[model samples]
Target: MMTNEINKTTGLIHNEGNFVGSAMLFPFNGKLFAITAGHNLYGKKFTDVPNLDNLTVSDHTKITHPIRCILGDSAFAKSHDIVLLELDCKTEISNFLPIRFCTIPRNPKHSLMFRGKYKNTEDPVTHRAITYTSTTTQSEHKFLCQIEKSLLMNHNYSSGSDWLGGWSGSALFIDNHKELICAGVMIEIPNKGNDGQLLFVNTLPLKDLGFESDIINAENLDFDKALNAASLAAIIDSFDEKTIREWEENNKNSEQLKFLNRKLNEIYPPDNIVKNKNKIIKQLLAGKAYLTTELSKNEQIFKQYNSAYKVYNLDSKEFYVNTKAEALTQLSGIKSSYEEYLIGNLGDDLPTADIKLLAIYGVSEWIADCSLDFLKYE
Candidate 1:
């Protein structure tokens, strides 16, 4: 439903702690801009914006280029978690992905496209590499919605790639008569059992956020060369082990062969899932304890901020509360409570051992909230 050319507009946005989220290039006011979830640009300390200066955009081939500029002084924080950044210079619309100008609930059957991370077992073909994927929405909420498929690498049910915590900010698009249009930006992974539902900031609201200028012009976009049937078959055949092995045997001195083998090993590295499970579960449980304590301390600090000023939602202006108590309730009630999050994510209903990975995700969400004062003020 999507083309490989989507790869050109997608890249990773690195957080303060080596944490990587996804991002995409957009054309606005006749200039190219980088867009992502507002949370990805926030620093761990939350006092000031983390430096993304000279940020480079990487492609599927692992090529990188610098972003021209970050539009405003800070990310446009709102209830939707969407942020629009200005590029340092103008670029051809062909260089970035195109956004769809459609009504909400575009269609129940629309295919969403994005470039996200995957593990060897989850997506053995492109582990550690940000690759293209097409998935559809299962349900939509008032502000955000869930992706029907999980993007984890080696889960219990399917051997397909699902998203990890690092996949935040990845752009979501739908195919409309072969035309790819941007829909939303990923913001969270829903912690409901083995279901790795992704939360995305719907981009249709960009118009209300001052991005309404010239968004629907198709002349600003470009399409990549389509792969013919024979070329597609040949490419798929190269993935065959027997073919690759024979090719290697024939080209004993081929550097390309050696490079290909090394890359394959990285994608499907030998590691026991059983051992990895035990280690991860133990770490998550211990981490939960530590974070619980930190959450209390963080709560007290937030109280100080709340008492000084009324808190505001960064993405959506309609949801500000009167008191810190009400605000905290709104924050925790975001989608679900911590207990629900733990129960839905921790139990054995899921197939993979990494389902507990959401525990750490819960911790980060709490930590980020503790610094809500740093986001935006009324």
Candidate 2:
């Protein structure tokens, strides 16, 4: 989405009686408010507090609204550059942008997009760039992301024009083929003539600081919904007698082939549904699933996942795994973990860097090596 198109959800934030930066309007706890960089509200480098009475945000129509309160941790202490301001008055929900929670893309080649108002310009500008993640700090609450210049350099504008001062607190968004999901928020920008890498804080840390998890959960649902829709669309688009014949030849013993054929025929039956292909595709493009209900529940939503093999916990209804382990190994780990939880031994040690690393990266490498060694020629 472009800057001019998203003005309804974007606004200028006035800090301590000055135009400090821009902020994005987001839904927080069933209400709407402006969220901006903590530095903007707490003063440069977080040295002084801004005048709360003078703190304000202006919507697309330039109507100013007073801030009710500021929430979240200190920028320097928590390493979270976010400041969630509670609104003193309610704004029209239609005028604000929809809030979407999403994880930062780990793929370096992934194209990311964000829009922000430039200090020198009247309109907000859109940017499309690839991301480079810098080293994670010890806090793990914040990480620096470098917004590399767009591969398509057809434009004449400078990189600073798209990601400089007055852009802090602007939402960095990515289209998930469903909706515009926010991945991060702008915190700092490189000086002019420097490699214009925009730095921002991922919004995930805010959850630990007491922001509701519901928004993130909804984002996951939207993501899954979009993926399913896209997959179904591709299958429908590629369906044909020749394709069915090829599938039959390739998967003669596959049990799922019959089910796939039945579903395809049901959607594009040679008679009635074929005529409505255009309309169906339009809905699909709008992120509507062909199926009325969810296909399945994905238990593994946490980014702290490390496993390819998941064994469900019958007692807690949770899924846990460390790698592609045999059924016996998985069961043993589950039993130990559950027992620890029962005896209150598990809750004592909060998650540390080692746990986080293990969860995120897994023991897959070691497991693979060991399995190869033990099962060789077996």
Candidate 3:
């Protein structure tokens, strides 16, 4: 997305008339979240209020809403340098960027941009032609980017504090030729002069924050290309029994490994079974299966399901569902089970982190049969 488009979803965080920092609307699962730098809420500069109840967010429309809850806190921010917030009002997802988590390491070859409000400004300024330097050694979670020199000089800041003071919690996007994928959040400036590099906390950590299956993989953004890349016969013929045996031998004792292996076998069965299941897999991928009717009611859910199926097929080398009827049955059962689980565990007194986790992974049942371990980062 472009800077002007992103500005529609960007907001400013305020505490008692003081401009804390910049924030952007993040759509995950079925909820809208506001993400910003952690220091804005928990840094030494702001000590009076440690929680979100005292905070409010104002977007470009100038409409303000009280924060409903703090899903992630300062402790997480200290390590991750990002804080996740929940707003009390409703917002259209179309106005915001799609939630695609960058899973690979970024380098100078990539085009980048930063969009956020500068000190109490209503409109966000776009900083273009950013250069990716290197990942910071202090933490694997953080990376460094040099701001375009001309843009930096035009701002004319005397010191690092003057340059980066109001820009905390701003968003960093990687332009992938087709669309801009949100890759990081601005956290700090490590140097003292006008040449200081902008330090950012990448979005990969959000998977560990319990958004693994919900966000789309940045690598798999071109769904149409992926769908047309190979035929079903080629996919089935490419399967290597030797490789499967080696993987099983390496992790023979792990129950999780066994489960994953069983699922893999189902995707690449005997020749007779492959002919039958191949039709099912193709129908599922093309959205012609029985579950498509139910999933189509919610566009977001359908998109997520489509992405999950594509990811599993391309990356994991497996397809889990056998038949259209079986998938529909499994989905219905999973929904019922999840509702019962929520009813039995969730209440008025659950911890904030626990509640956040539940909300984040609430849709895991949609892909319950697929292995999600590939979503995690090392």
Candidate 4:
């Protein structure tokens, strides 16, 4: 492995619309793939992933090729904020990107001990914060963070670390020198008032999210040299909640509706089984439409992004809450929390809704809404 001075850890988020995270490189299906946080690409447009040939690093064109976005309440947010993508790269077999990632499929293979220079402490909580030198900020202050925690704070929470922005999705390696190892995914910088630690999510806990299977690692002689090499195959378009649901609903309804119609035939028997042809046909059609609408509605709602709604017995005016909240209410005294139950066990299912393309205004307006991500499980 080539060795050089630890270069400045600054990444240029090129995915359209300023996805402020680091890119990951991994091997997938005989080609190199790049990974990013899923929520970063939710509500985007594109058919195929982009390549450097189409757009390069820090190019102003970044506003065009958006990353695929994941929802706040989805399972992706719970286990980990990770997404694997493919990149178009042509490199020699012997050469690998300086920072390469391993799939969670084999994440255990690379586990090792971490010694936090900033945390000062040795042991780290699995998803807790650690200390890392800030490249963007001029302050010598250490940052507080927790992304799949791998280190403890060297000093107590005197001040918080400032990741600035665009540091999420960054790959962290423990002991970059002798005991080098790929560790976690960076999500955000700690607030100035945070307990002086760098935040990151460990890739280990998120292995089950299928991100590792899609990782596209770009090997490099130097960290900076690996920019284009490390970036994932640009998502020429993203399948956001708005798009995924529509695509899934249309495709699923077409297929399931056919199946349901056949089932209806079993129940109604094609009218030939009875004598009143037009009357029976008309009655059958009406019933078929009603059932189809109900079931199809269920399937459609089930396929949308991280939202859960109760089949409100219109009689009950109170909005339903989830069991997670109910469980919390037992202690927190928010007794009404138990009413809304999550739509799915994993909260990965999509909600049925007519989705539309998100304009710049839509995103700006939802900044606060995005922060208050409604956890279906919660």
Please provide, for model 4 over 51-93, each residue's C-alpha lDDT reduced to its tens digit, 9 standing for 90 to 100.
Answer: 3333322211121222233222234443355555444444431
Lowest lDDT sum, 10 consecutive residues, model 1, at 120-129
C-alpha root-mean-square deviation, candidate 3: 18.6
lDDT of 2 at 190: 47
Off by over 4 Å in 2: 1-5, 73-78, 146-163, 191-193, 215-378
TM-score of each: 0.43, 0.52, 0.53, 0.32
Model 2 per-residue lDDT tens digits across residues 1-378: 222355566778876556778887766566777667788777666777666787888877887888877776465423677877777654565566566666655444334566667665677766765364663554354445555555212246655433356788887765323555666778776454256466767777666657764444423443254544433444345445554445446654244333333333433435653333333223332222222211222333222121211322223322233332442255346435534442342123222321222221222221212211112122
- Predict model 4's lDDT versus the native: 0.33
Report the backbone clash tally of model 3. 1
- Cα RMSD (angstroms) for every candidate in the order listed: 26.0, 15.1, 18.6, 24.5
Q: Tell me the deviation in Å of residue 271 in model 4.
A: 99
The better-scoring model by lDDT among 1 and 4 is 1
Better of 1 and 3 by lDDT: 3
Task: Estimate candidate 2's alpha-carbon lDDT, on a 0 to 1 scale.
Answer: 0.52
Provide the lowest-lDDT 10-residue window in model 2: 367-376
Compose the digit string of candidate 1's lDDT tens values, residues 1-378: 344466666665543334355677655556667677766665322235556663555543444545555543343443446667665543445566554543333233223456554322121121111212323353331124444443353346452323355566776654323455665666666553145345566565556566664344222221111212212232333344444345446655255334333322322234643332333233333334332322222344324323322322233312355554454455446424433544453333322222233334443333323322212236
Q: Model 3's lDDT to the true fold?
A: 0.56
TM-score of 1: 0.43
Ranking by TM-score: 3, 2, 1, 4
